[model samples]
Target: MLHSIRAIVNGSTNFILTKMFDENLGFKEALLLAQQLGFAESNPTLDVEGFDALNKWTIFLCHAYGIVTTPDQILFTGIQNIHKSDALVAKARGQQIRLVAQAKKLVDGGVAAFVLPQFVLADNPLSFVKNEYNGVVIESGFADQQFFYGKGAGSFPTASAVLSDLSALRYGYKYEYKKLYHHEPNQLNDDIYLRVYVSFTDVKNIPTEDFEWIEQWHAQEDRKYLSGVIALKKLKTTIWWKENGTSLILEPDPIIENIEVRKLKKKAWNWLDYCRINLI
Candidate 1:
């Protein structure tokens, strides 16, 4: 049998809502059920990685533009790799990290969607959005830009948004959601700080040739300690070994090319594990 409901009403949308059904059920499971019921999709990537913000943005685009598109066509990035050290530095510098999902209408009658992590200065409105809160900014030629902010995730929050959409649909509002091919890839440009640990067989023979661009702040050869920051452009290659214990912090060069940041993240994670640093 096939069944459809306008929408479900709820109070809170926190993880607790999923827990009420099954102790082991999670947000992904609940979303999967909704997808199977034709209410959503099995977008494990977004639900697990927080790119669901982009999914919500895609729905909004369809409503505003009278067309259809999927979040897959948009640029996406998640904060799953952001380390505690980076967060600490951001806090020290009076900054906060935010998951920003955006959609823009191009001047030439095109649309764009993107989901990425951003470091917002303390003064930005985005910085004020705390955990699980969602905010959107809309722009149009006829009307001034509009901003909407509210509880973005959780079962109750999503239910509210769905109910609102259902109401519009019942009033004869018709919208088409479509999937489009996104040919344009997103290029990430940002400053990243990485903490690393290193060890060398012969401390005296350690080559500084590969790290000429790295700024050495302090070193203690007796304890085999080397901590510094290197510009991403200066990194020619990285070699790792279990025996060579090392610790260092690096900043991405302003113009880094030919390397995926994910590789750097893996290296950092390994170093952290070796150093027995608590990544969490």
Candidate 2:
């Protein structure tokens, strides 16, 4: 069975975010340019707020794994809450922030999905894709992994996709989606562990108890962030996570088992076979 599909299905917001990182443009400034260039609509609520990615994710689900789901049927997070500080933290660690829509086949044959912004490490292939380009990484038992990339938005980009469908008529093409009908039902759960970064304003209000083992936390008069591993479902139920002026990024788990960071500033750890500060 297919394991997972992680996609960046929205282009407009991606373009806007890419500009913010590459050019140091503010959110509104990048958004205006995205609109002027036709990458984004005048009202980009769907794109910026992740509804567009949710819709696209459902479509991909129907075709890839043959599961029917709607935007409201799943949990989703948008990119509007992202800050320049968030991107700076990622960049300082040689990473970039990207909006990701992910659908996974659970171990119990159940399905789960969500859309959120992620801090992608420089070594990840997804990190290379920027601007209006869209990428999908398909993980499966048989094939192991496969990645596909293309333009996911724009009039010409959309037109070309339609043209491909029209051209397929000569070869008789159709989506098989053989696994659509199944016993599994789509659901959300906290069984999955995630390494997350949470930013807060009030120094005294941060929920230190919510995290199982906090690896590192930064607090200042203006800037603050917490890094640790926690269950997604549990984090969602917290008021601190649901409140405004808060942001979260799920980081990849380290390769080393029971890894401990003693002095991150003095010594280097081979978490991804490179020099990286181990937050846990």
Give me the candidate number with maximum lDDT: 2
Question: What's the true lDDT of residue 92 in model 2?
Answer: 89
Residues 12-124 of candidate 2 have per-residue lDDT tens digits of 87898799899888788888998888899889998988888888888787776667766766656777777788878887888888888887776654566667788887877
Per-model CA lDDT versus the true structure: 0.42, 0.73
Residue range 1-280, candidate 1, lDDT tens digits: 0010011011112222223122434444544554554334344454435455556655654554433666545544443333344445446657654555544443333443445444456766655555345555555555655556666555676688799899998899855433223333222222322223233334554455444233232343343433433433233233331124322222211112225445654665577676586644
Give TM-scores for every candidate, taking all chains together and pairing residue i with residue i: 0.43, 0.78
- Model 2, poorest ten-residue lDDT window? 254-263
> With candidate 2 superimposed using the best TM-score fit, by how many Å does residue 132's alpha carbon deviate from the native?
0.6
Q: Which candidate tops TM-score?
A: 2
Q: Write down the worst ten-residue block by lDDT for model 1.
A: 1-10
In model 2, the clashing pairs are none
Model 2 per-residue lDDT at 121 = 77
lDDT value for candidate 2? 0.73
